[model samples]
Target: MRYLPLEEITEDMCLARPIFNGDGRVLLSNGVKLSKNYVSRLKEMGYQNLYVYRVGEEISDFSTPISDQTMREAIHGVKDAFGKAAQRQQLNIRDVNEIVSYILDEILTNPNVLYNLMDIKNHDNYYYHHSVNVCIISTLIAKEMGLAREKVKDLTTGALLHDLGMVCVDPRILSQPRKLTEDEMATVREHTNYGFQLLRSERNLSILVAHTAYQHHERMDGSGYPKGLVGEDIHLFGRIVAVADSYETMTSGRVYRKAMWSHEAIRQLRESAPEKYDPDVVAAMERSIAFYPVGSVVVLNTHEEAVVVDVNAKKITIQFSSGPRVNALMDLEPDSEIKIEERLS
Candidate 1:
């Protein structure tokens, strides 16, 4: 399956993966042939890219660190938990814990998998999807850093609910397409305190979990919000979530900005490391994320355009787009002189 920008998707290209709505219902099922109308509609809905089967190529499901069902359940659990909290009802800590546990198990099972944040997102439920993405990425970073299993669980739980305080903010303010006023920005920053109070009140949750919500915004150089804490003042869990949260936020489409490419996001993180982010945590994140995700179209130093088929392969697999080697598969050796120049999409 090739991941292509919506603008490049033409009629009759079959979808290789299902697209889900905010409620987790399938908007378009796998193997559905795309038409011009379907493509237009999807673009209108803010979908940036899609997974489609390359001509005459049939394959089994594309592998992910966690299954689609698990992602849907996690989104549902986060949405439901936020809803309950918004209504002043008890948050479903057990449901959230179960979702995190399942995610942790999947990551542990595939310890060597480099996570690709390529899931199609629905704009209406950005928070739910963002929460899950941060949790998954945080878990991967934790595992890569060799944190203990129990600590990983705590980090996962904290990362999953890091934005729980946003439930208290007005939805309109959160979705505003324009720059937030200084007053409006203050209200949004208060979410950390709001979330911390809410999580701390839960008898079953750890204090560290509550701190994750409070400190994910705090930076290493004492420039972050809610608190200007420098390095070490931020808890380990908080520092870890901060990296995951920032990376996910930057790479995710938001009301005010478009999503960034993974490589671009990584570059920004590296540029700001040990200042706005913990250098160690950022390094762990780099080890866990796929800079060149599968299904991406990239340009090689040899001036050949190829589509990445598998990043996890011992030698990465690339299919040349055209020329004498058109449609030919080549293994990109780790130390080869030929290198990827840039990604086209």
Candidate 2:
């Protein structure tokens, strides 16, 4: 299967994976042959990419960090909880905890897998999807940093609701396709305080979890918002979440800006670390994510095009867009001279 942009997808391509709605229902099942109408409708629905099988290619399951069913359920839970919170109702803490536990369990079951952020995105459910992505990334980072199991669970929970304050902000500002004014930007930044208050008010939740919402925007050099606490002043959970949150947000598409590629997003994070983000937390994140996810098309230093087949082994299948195509598998080891020059998509 190949991951291609929606604009690049053509008619008669078989969908390699299922497309689910915001409510966890399958909108298009796997192996469905896409027609002109299917592609146009998907684009109209704001889908950016699709996983399609190539000609004569065998269908194989493309695994995610967590299963699609679990991801859909988590997103649904987040949407439900945030909608209730937006209505000034108390958040269902038990439901939120269960969602976090399920995500943690899935990650813990295979802690060594490099997380691939391949989930499809839609503008309508951006916040909910972003929340779940942050939670999964934060959980992986926490485990890689060797946090206690219980602490990992707490971090996962906090990461899941880090953006709860967004519900209090004006939706017009968030969905607008233009730059925000100074006042509007300030209003957006206030979500930290708003989320902190909401989370802190829950008696059954830990104060540290609330801090994750409050301090995730705080920078290592005291340049962040809500509060300008310097390094070590921010709680460990906050620091961990700060990195995860930034990575997830940068790699996700928004109404105002296009999404950054995973490798470029990681580069920005690494470049800003020790000043804008925690160096140790960034390091942990670097180890947990796959810079080049499976099914990604990349250019080799030798000027050949190939598709990534296995992220763990850095294995790729050589192919081309034109001329005689060759199918060969090669591992890109650390010591190997053959290196990935750039990601095409």
Candidate 3:
């Protein structure tokens, strides 16, 4: 199975895996043969890419740190939680805790797996999807940093609800496809304080969680919003969530722009490290996500094309060429000249 841009999809291909809506409903089933009409409709609906297999090609098993069952439940839980928060109603802290526990367990079990943020998004529920993706990425980074399990859980909770203030913003403004005026930008920026207030008001929640929502937008150089705090003045949880939130948002498609490739996003984070984001946190994030994720096609230094089947130790497992004679390259010699030259979606 390979990921292809919408323009590359043809009637000769088939869906290698199912696509789901934000509510967990399957929009397209696995193994469905593609047609010109289906491709056009998907494009009309804002789909950027798809996982496809050429006719007669084998479908590989897709795996992630979390299970499908847990993902569905978490999505439903986040949707409900967001709705109540938007209405200023009392939130069920116990329910939220249970959801966080499930996610933490999954991350702990697959400590080595790179978190994939590609499949969890859809146009209908951007907020909920973004929330879950942030939580997943943040938890992975926390674990990579060797934080205590308690700290991991705390970070997970903070990441899950980091964008709570967006609920108070006008949906029209939040989804606006054009640049915002200064007044409109100010209104949007208030989400940090709005979220901090809501989280702080809950007696059952920790003050640290409130700070997470507060400082996730802060920068290391005092250029961030709300408080514009500088350096270590920001809480560690906040710093961690800031990296996760930024990486997730950069790699995700938004109303104003297309999603970035993982390598490009990582490069941006590295470039801003120590000045904007904490250098350590940026390094942890890079270690926690695959630069060449599974199913990505690439051109190699050997002038051959390959598909990435797995990733380990900053290197990828590849199957070269597109012919039926498949050979897996598990590891490169220390002096091997072969390297990934480019990523082709």
Candidate 4:
């Protein structure tokens, strides 16, 4: 099913997925037909559309964002904890360790949870969710980079708070749809410095993490903002967060464009601007993400339909229950047997 904007809402639109209140009461279950009330409640809650199957290919004129209820709850819990931490007027070392440990535990036990969050782009909860996504990606990248456990936890906290400066920026700039002019983007760039300042303001905050806010956007070629530190000059926490943040932002749906299908996003990253991003970090991210997520449907080269089963670092894994498998890899033999037609955007 595709998502449809509220402006085009109609009774014919069947609920392709579950619709529920923030409290978890089901307003409509999967397969339930849409009605005026269902649409109204969605609008009331600030949602602009519903996911529905159209004539043939799934389509959504409305920006139907992927939702992970568990992630939302986790972010809320983290937000509240931080609120408490702020009111207490100090970040206790033990408490900070506990928070990082919990985040690491979640990542270690449920890796897919992190990948799923990478797909969601809730405008209402960007900061908390982006923090969670960054932590997951940074920790994974750190592990791949061979950092030790203690170092991993420290870097993870830094990744989680990398965007903490956005809290100080004008909300209008953050949410603007049209591309920012140079002047606005310059202010946007200050998020790194602002984030550094915010964390520095807290006497008890972790200085390493605070620095991540400053250095996360720095590039190896010294093209990044706030500081143009290159290569070894940049902090490890900053470097890790840079890769994670870009991947998360690219995959998340935006008001201006439908989210790039995972495969396409990965392709772009792999090609790289060279000299800008570290080649090693790019490799790590490619291995860790599923460009074509499982449960997503795509057209196959065989001129038939299929659901994506898995996404590997080198090539997407598909299960062709109905036909022969295609050679999606080898350049000597690019799959004539089957090809993914397109992602259900």
Candidate maximizing TM-score:
1
Candidate numbers, best TM-score first, in rank order = 1, 2, 3, 4
Clashes of each: 0, 0, 0, 4
Question: lDDT (CA) for every model shown?
Answer: 0.84, 0.82, 0.81, 0.61
- Writing each residue's lDDT as its tens digit, candidate 4 over 1-345 gives 444565675777776655444323344566766688867866655454455543333422211112345444445544653454335444444555566677666555543332522232345555666676777777777766777777787687777667766756677998886678898888888888867876777765568878887998888889887879988788867877888888777766656655566677767867764576777887877666665565466666556555554443334445443445442322111344556767653
Off by over 4 Å in 1: 59-62, 313-315
lDDT of 1 by residue, 72-146 (tens): 899888889888889878888888889988998899888467776376875777788888889988999998889
Q: What are the C-alpha RMSDs, in order, of all predicted structures?
A: 1.8, 2.2, 2.2, 6.6
Where is model 3 more than 4 Å wrong at Cα?
312-315, 322-337
Q: Identify the leading candidate in terms of lDDT.
A: 1
For model 2, the superposed segments whose C-alpha errors exceed 4 Å read 313-325
Cα distance off (Å), candidate 2, residue 124: 0.7
TM-score for candidate 4: 0.72
User: Which candidate would rank higher by lDDT, 1 or 3?
Assistant: 1
lDDT of each residue in 155-200, candidate 3, tens digit only: 8988999999888998888767667989999999999999999999
